[model samples]
Target: MGATTVLGLARRAAVGVAGAMGLTWVVRAAWGIPSAMGASVSAIAPVAVASARYRNRQFHNTEPSTQVAPGSAVSLLLSALTRQGVGRPLGAIPLATPEVPERAGALAVTWYGHASVLVEVDGYRILTDPVWSERVSPSPVVGPARLHPAPAPLSELPPVHAIVISHDHYDHLDRETVRELVRSQDAPFVVPIGIGAHLRKWRVPERRIVELDWGASYCLTGTGPGADDLVITCTEARHFSGRGLIRNTTLWASWVIAGPTRRVYFGGDTGYTTAFAAIGATSGPFDLTLLPIGAYDVHWPDVHMNPEEAVRAHADVCGGEPGYGLLVPIHWATFNLAFHGWSEPVQRLVTAAKAAGTTVAVPLPGQRIDVNALSPQVPWWEDVRRQ
Candidate 1:
């Protein structure tokens, strides 16, 4: 073939490849678009407007909060680019096969990593912030991918009494996980006020979508003896919510799970807030408290709780007593969402909790901890960090 003929064929081949790539991008974008944006403002407005916290068209925190600190945007961007390998474990993050019993125990918790937890209280099981997706983003191909695989498949989870969502953020309220749970479980999704619109968009049955404002409570009755009533309460948290560019159209909250004989607190994600003290006064002195101790940075001080703040929050929710409850750290190990060392949160948490006279359980991903039979603190993450 002549030089011109060969060049012409190469150009045509490049065009064909480019067209195929463009088509693939269109297909992926189309698949994620609906679930990613999640309910229009009109659909969410009717419900959100009625709440006391809803004013001027979006939800607001009791105390003012800045999602990102003033003048920190440039520094945050710089940090994001420069910080390398600090957020990941040096070796494989250990996983455990959750030992779930046929009947839910009196009080136990299985940490599935990065805010996904299964809580068992008085024979009823409640799952919190269950994100089973590989990437906590609208697009599957991009965003903060999981550092480690989910300890167990969604199908492996036993029948839960309820699935509770703290906020509408991609990390906590996942679209794919919700769809899977809707198919596999019959439990209702107990969420904060405006999140029902998102669930509705995802085709979650109306009967199974329970939306509550701060201080609102939902009582669930389970089958069998000692399972008479489990009350799930939406309490306060210092955080913001948004799945897309539009922010706080939905509400964020901590949850109070109170069984007849046992009580647990699931702090989905939050900065330290004074409201925790009020929550403790009304419905706490809890047996266990699962609080976020990760994805925290100085730039966003009013949002995610650092390890020290988490310890204080634990005490505030446990009736103003430092050593009142068993604190288990979440929102750290599975996803590298912040710039801290992989094991730094837990290490700082352990030190802070010790100083506060607080007892804490650092469970491996998917490891079950029975509140009654508490175990000694094992520095498991130290080994992982050193590796």
Candidate 2:
């Protein structure tokens, strides 16, 4: 009995020391949230407990039934651990050529990174999912850190008429970026329901934030009302959302911007669901479709679409033809959020799109390829990946 008691005491002391060191390391990490580490622990602990309870009680809960594959978990951990070692050349990367001056009256889109894009339609600019943070995690010290620096500072962006957010995921809705935007720009913030709570938490003015549910239409004229003709409507996205602690307490969404001349759809992260076809049947025949093509794996097939599904999604939204309009792939090249090789998503997308006779454009990050311009096949990611 005495021997067992002594062993238990020693084990407890060792565990306590290791835990203290871990806490110190997390608190002192170079990333952003030096002060909020304690708060993060409190926030996430309750959610984890709730998840456990829900899993036990709910019949709808699905757990990973199969055993974890060999080396899969190890690879994920090492990729995350050595994020900085990958060595992305930030300075040598080229900036995208702006097409705004060329396409004065037509709609144009400039992708910042991930789902963040600047869409200029009929002279009115709409910014979507603008994440300017260095990392996309609830905690700055850990989680999927960004591979490359932002192409341009958020402050350097031109005057945007409006800003749109798809969901409340850390990558999709960054708090720091939101605060900076609220202070820097005069544009009204458009987002799905419950995401406004986050903006309010960050002290954004109530009048500047507009929350919309699925199928709700909000009109946007030019600078002044009726200066230009454009209407933006919040549509549904088959995804989930949460920030800090709460999961799916908010909503995820897509947007349909109908210009006088053409209609466009932004499928803000979603799986391959029948909703796309329904959306097409209702407000589509889109001239252009911006789709996600990365951060997908077989494990979460119902959450994010792969490259092939992206092509099919484009066909469902736009007409089922290649030359019908244009398919510009977004949600990649900005951040390394997936387990696959960095360039694999676009390479696979290009091949699948070609087989389907779809006209796809893989623009370099920050580069703009005008739909009206005669596009030349410039495979830029090949050399970058080889490097």
Which candidate gets the maximum lDDT versus the true structure?
Answer: 1
Candidate 1 lDDT over residue span 1-387, tens digit each: 999999999999999999999999878756776667699888999999989999888999999899999999889998989885689889999888999888889999999989999999988899999999999888887789899899999999999989999999999999899999999999999999999999999999999999999989999976665448889999999999988888999999999999888899999999999998999899989999999999999899999999999899889888987578799999998888888999999999999988999999999998999998988877889899888
Clash list (residue pairs), candidate 2: 96-366, 96-367
After superposition, which runs of candidate 2 have C-alpha atoms over 4 Å from their true positions? 1-25, 28-105, 223-226
Clashes of each: 0, 2
TM-score of each: 0.96, 0.78
Native-to-model Cα distance after best TM-score fit, residue 115 in candidate 1, in Å: 0.8
**All candidates' lDDT scores?**
0.91, 0.72
Candidate 1 clashes between residue pairs 3 or more apart in a chain or in different chains: none
Candidate 1: where is the Cα deviation over 4 Å? none
Which stretch of 10 consecutive residues in model 2 shows the poorest summed lDDT? 57-66
The candidate maximizing TM-score is: 1
